[model samples]
Target: MTLVKSLYAGIATASFVLAALPAAAEDDVKIVASFSILGDMVEEVVGDLATVTTIVGPDADAHVYQPSVADARAVAQADIIFVNGLGFETWSDTLISESGTEATVHVATAGITPVKVDGMTDPHAWNSLSNGVIYVTNVAAAMKEAMPEHAGEITANADAYIAELEALDAETKSKLADLPANRRTVVTAHDAFGYLADAYGLTFLAPVGIATEAEPSAKDLAVLIDQLKAEGAAALFVENITSPALVQQISEETGIVIGGRLFSDALSERGGPATSYLTMFQHNLGTLLDALAHETAS
Candidate 1:
């Protein structure tokens, strides 16, 4: 896997970027997204207008993805590429350059103000549904520009998709509204939930930092263990893209209940609970509410 580079400053994206891209010559509007979540968002907006390909597959980690020959070939043939750009896919720049492709790389998290933790930019913007709306809107706008013939259909699809997102956002807020300030503490393997916590009135804790590849030092682990024992986490969750060992260890030490698995960085397999972005969010919300709201693990 490729080690993600340092934080980037100007992570920008637009509601659209394929302004000069010619209309689909044949019916193939090939798009390459950086990861599974981004790919699913693109699919929702583009509908069947394009064939979306994801570089990082389900249950995979993008923070340390090493692009393979197959990845290069896909990018080389793609007309457009979407990435989470707040330094999320730090390996992307090298991959796109080496792919020898002229495809336009669009930053999905373009307009959303990024959240930084301990001075490092947090790249998991899609954790917030408001920002998620921006991601698909950007894809839809670019798609409309690239294929004017399907503009009407694209707009309709985007509208419906955005509505569902907004409805769910409201629902999640309502479901979590009564969670007291004290009960909003969420613990996980890494700091991937900063955006989600910010969006839903919850506080998140993790042993390591944002990138799963960065191992936590003994000092860091000790401090976190002390903190958890002191304040206590409402529930512990294991993310799909990360190893469950750290969370299990933490659970054993703290005796905090392990709330079922949460899909943080990736989706699940074809028949699994979280196969797409929407289903992933729904599953995560249900899991958290069940664990945090009711503490059902006992």
Candidate 2:
């Protein structure tokens, strides 16, 4: 049998323990994440504990992700897998099957009650810092369970990470508090920021619904343009995971200057501004504030 099958078989037969395993078995702790953003979060808590890999790379749209054979092979070898769940990767089940991986699947969204994406439950719970805290907790718990000897260390790391996330949650609310009720309306290319909007009291608007797979109808765009003009919208933004052409068209039609690009569904590649979740949130907030401040000035 393949090494993956062997690993799963061993996990099934053995009981949980807290001691270190053999040196040769160290590489067996492979982790597969659904996308770049989730991979980043998993890495922060797990640190150097495992070989982390992501199926959807930077700036890839997860809503319509199609996993490749290579991705399947990677998943098949992992000791554990982390998924955002809540229907984020619509084809995740198929990916798991194709991989033939019996690795335990851990849903990072375990405790997050996600916001609705255009009335339907969306899987992008990481948009909210509170939900991010839940994700880190779940990751730490899964790691500690799988590698028992490291339980105490993993728990301590998770606690420190939780403290940072809590601070970020507070900062988001504080940063957004300056915007008046009417000026709280924000528009973007897709419906990925429902959780962020809900958490910080912003009214989110998107011509396209839950996923970027759907194109905005011309009628919808016209309606959005009219409404934005009437409301004196503070800003419009393009998502990092989506093409900018549509957002540019909307900006041109509405005469609203395009704010800086926002990190929505994905994280930036290494060395980029939004390499981490906290940086991504701060970048988006700064962009919004700059645009709104400009509106106030003019």
Q: Which candidate is the best by TM-score?
A: 1
Q: What local distance difference test score does each model get?
A: 0.85, 0.80
Tens digits of per-residue lDDT for model 2 on 166-284?
A: 99889878878888776787788888888888888887788888888999888988998898888756777888888889888878887777877999988888887788887887888
- For residues 4-80, write the lDDT of model 1, one tens digit per residue: 23111111111022333455567688999999999999898888878999999999999988776667667777888
Where in model 1 is the C-alpha error above 4 Å?
1-25, 295-298
**lDDT of model number 1:** 0.85
Clashes of each: 3, 2
Q: How displaced is residue 70 in candidate 1, in Å?
A: 1.0
Q: TM-score of model 2 relative to the true fold?
A: 0.88
Poorly placed runs, candidate 2 (over 4 Å): 1-27, 296-298
